[model samples]
Target: MKRQRAFFHTLRLPRFRRITLPLLLLLVFTATSYSLVGRQTATVPLPGLVMIDAGHGGYDPGVMSNGILEKDITLAIAKQLQAALQARGIPTAMTRDSDIDYADSGTKGSSSKRSDLNKRLELTEIQQATVFVSLHINNSTLATRGGAEVFYSEQNEGTAELAAAVQSELHKIPQMSKRDAKPGKYYLLRNQEIPSLIVECGYLNIADERARLNTADYQKKLAEAIANGLDSWLQKNK
Candidate 1:
C-alpha cells in the first residue's frame, strides 16, 4: 500500500508528468510511423515516378564487340529515357549521368561492382520509384540473334504489365521489329521490391544491329519508343 501510494505521488509530480507524457507520446508516434512505412513497402503495383539504371560502368564495359561498348549505349539510352519522361512532366531518376560507376573508382575486383549495385538499390529506395528499368545491350553466342527484348521479374505483380507495355512499344520501332517480352533472372530485377524490368535495346553481336545501335538517330528512336510505352502503361494504371 505504501509503495503504491509512492508511485501515485511520483506520477503527480510536475517534472515526472511533463517528461513521462512527452516520452509516451513520442513512442506512440514513432511506432505508428514505422507501421505505416512497412505497409507502404509491402504494397504492390507501385505508381508515380520511374527509376532508370544504366547498367555497367567504370572499369566494367559490359558486352563489347565490333568496336562498340555496352556501357556507352546503356548510358545513352538511360539519359534519353530520362529526358523523354521529363519532357512530359513525369518525374524520373537516373542511376548514372556519366561513364563512371557508383563503386569506388580505383578499387580492384568485384567489390567495386557490388558497391555500385548496392548504391543503385539505395537510390531506388530513396526515390520510392513506381518502376525500375535497367538499360543494357544484349549479347549471345549466336551472332544471328538481334532485336530488342524486354525482360521482367515474376515476383512483382505489375512487372508483367510493365514489360508488355514497353515491349509493345519497342516492337513498333523499325529496328526492334516484333521481339517479345521475356522472363529473366537478373539480379537488379529480382532484388528490386518494386515493379522492375530490363530493356535489352539490341544484340551487339549482329553486324547490322551493332551498326544501327552506334548511330545517334537509332538511339533517339529507341528512347522515343520506350517513352511512348511508359506513357501508355501509366495511362492504363491511372
Candidate 2:
C-alpha cells in the first residue's frame, strides 16, 4: 500500500509528467485540460452542442466568383469542422450538408431568413447548444481584399468574444491573415440566442485565396484552427 502511495506521489510530481508514459499520454490528448492522465478522468468539451451552418446550398451558390461556388466551400469547411469537433468529442449539427437550397423568398424557399434563423434559435433552446458558427466565403471586385473575417451579432457580447477567440486562433496558422471581428446582420448570428459567430473563410474574388480554399489540405487546417478556437473558449468558460 505504501508503494502504491509512493507511485501516486511520483505522478503528482511535475518531473514525473515528463517521463515516457506521461509524455505519450499528453500527445494522445493534446490541449485538453488534464495532463497526461486526464484522458479518462476529465470530460472533453466536444460532448457539448454546437450548430455548424454551411452557408448556401443547392442552386444557391451564395457568393460566386471566378467559377467557385460559396456553397461548396462552405460545406467543405463545415464538414471538416464537424469532423474536427467530433474528434475532440464535441457534438455538432449542420444546417445543411448537401447542395440544396434554402431561400430568402417564395413558398418553397420563401421562409423569411429571420424566421428560419429564429427556428434555429428554438432548436438551440431545446438542445442547450454551447455555440453557433456559420461558415461563409467573401467576394469583392478587387482581388486586393483578402483574409479571414469573423462576425458576431450585436446582441450577444459572449458571441463576439467567442468570435474573437476563433479569429485569434485562425490567425496563428501559417498562411491565414487576421481581420477584425465585425458585427454582421446575418440571420444565424442575429436570430440565435446562443453565442454565435460567422466565419468568412476567405475572399472568392482573390485567385490565390480561392484556390487555397478549394484544397482539402487547407480546409483541414481551417477546421483544426476552428476546433482549437472552440476548445480554448470552452476551457475558459467551463
Candidate 3:
C-alpha cells in the first residue's frame, strides 16, 4: 500500500499535468500500433508479379479538390509504394515515371485525351503483369465523405482476391476503416488480362482528406499500406 501511494505521488508533480498524460497516451498508442503492424506483416503475402499504375497522368488530371491534382498525389504514393515493395524483394513495375502532360523539357504531350490514352494503352504489350493496380484519388458530389475503397474487374477472380488483400491492409491503419471490395469496370482492370485492382485512396472532395492526401507523410503511409496488401496477396497466392 505504501509503495502504491508513493508511485501516485511521483505522478503528482506539476510537470505530470502537462507531460505525463500526453506521454502515457503516446505510449499506449505506440504499443497498439506496433502490435497491429506485427499482425499485418505476418499476414501479408508477397506475390511475385506486381504492377503499379498512377491513375490520370499526362493529359488527365483525374480528380481535383481544393485545386489539389489527383495526378500529383497518385504519382507520389506510387513511387513511395514501389520503394517499399522493392525493399522487401518484391518485384514491381510502374506505367509512367514522369508527368504525362508535359515532356521532360516542359513541352506538351499528346494534345488530345484520346491520343493520350492510346499511348497509355500501349503499356499492355510490355509484359503480362501478375497483378495490376491502378492508384487513384476519389471524388464525390458530397464533400463530407471520405475513405479508401478497392475495386476489382469482374473479368477475373484473382482481381477480387487482390482487392480484398489491399482493403484488409488499409484497414490496419489507425483511422482507416475496412471497406469491402466491389466489382468495377475500370478499363485498366477490365482490359488487362492479369488480375487487376483499382484503389481509390480517399475522396479528395472532402477538405480534410484532400489536405491529408497532399502531405508526404500520408503518402508514405499510403504506399506502405499498398505494399502490405500486395505482399499479403503474394504470400498466400504464390
Candidate 4:
C-alpha cells in the first residue's frame, strides 16, 4: 500500500492540482460543447467561396403541395447544406437565412420578384463568391415524377463539369433517381460570371419524396450528398 499512498500524495500536491484541475475542466468543457453543438469545429479552409441561394421566400412560396411550402423546405435544406459545407471546412454564404426576401418595394419600375433576384445576384458579386448553388423544390402535375435534378448555366465554362460532379454524387443516394445534369437558362445562373447551378432537390408533388424532404434526417442526408459533390469538384479543380 506504500506505492498507492505515494501516488495519492503526489496528486494532492499544489503544483499537481494547479495543472491537472484546469486540464480536467477543459476536457469537460470541450466534451460538453461538442455534445451541445452536434458538430465538430472546422479548422482548415477550402479554396473557393460558395454562395447558396434558398429560392423563393416570403410572399413568393414557389410551389405548395400537400401542405408543404417550397420556400420553407428550400430554406431548411439550404441551412443544412451550409452546415454540411462548413463541417467540411468549405467557406459558404447564403442569400437568405430566414423566411424573408430581399425585395425592395421602393425600387421603381422593378417587380418584387425581379428586385429579389437582383439583390441575390448583387450579394454574390459583393461577396466575391466563386460558385453559386440555388436550392429549389420541383413541382410536377404527375405525382410519379420525383428525384433531384441539377442544371448548370452554359454562360460559365466549367459550370457543366461542376453540375455533373454534383449530379453524380446525388445519384449515389439510395433510391435517388439517376438524372443527368442539363443546361439551364435560369436568370440567376445566366447572370453569374462564376460557375453556377440550380439544384431541384426533389418533387414536392410526389408523396414519398415530399415526406422525405420534410424530415430533418433526410434533409441532412441530402445536404451531405451535395457537400460531398462540391468537395469532389473542388478537389479536381484545385
Q: Give each model's whole-structure lDDT.
A: 0.74, 0.69, 0.67, 0.77
User: Highest lDDT among the candidates is held by which one?
Assistant: 4
Query: TM-score of model 4 relative to the true fold?
Result: 0.78
Which candidate would rank higher by TM-score, 1 or 3? 1
In model 3, the runs with Cα more than 4 Å from the true position are: 1-47, 101-115
Query: Roughly what TM-score does model 3 have, to 2 decimal places?
Result: 0.72
Model 2 agreement with the true structure over 1-238: per-residue lDDT tens digits: 1101000001111111234788668746773433321222222333346777777665457898777888899989988998887676666766655665433344334454444455445544544466888888999886586888888887975777788888888898777766888789876766766788889899988888888999999988988988889877766675
lDDT of 4 by residue, 1-238 (tens): 1111000000011111234678767655654211111323222222477788888887678899888999999989898988887776667878777777766755433476788898789767755677899999999887476889999999888888899988988988888877789999888988889999899999988888999999998888888888889877876776
Model 1: per-residue Cα lDDT over 158-223, one tens digit each: 778889999998888875657889889987887889888899999888888899999888888888
Q: How do all models score by TM-score?
A: 0.77, 0.73, 0.72, 0.78
| Prediction-by-prediction clash tally | 0, 7, 10, 0
Superposed Cα deviation of residue 102, candidate 4 (Å): 1.1
In angstroms, give how far residue 191 of model 3 lies from its true place.
0.6
In candidate 2, the residue pairs with backbone N, CA or C atoms under 3 Å apart (3 or more residues apart, or in different chains) clash, namely 46-89, 46-90, 57-100, 58-99, 58-100, 105-110, 106-110
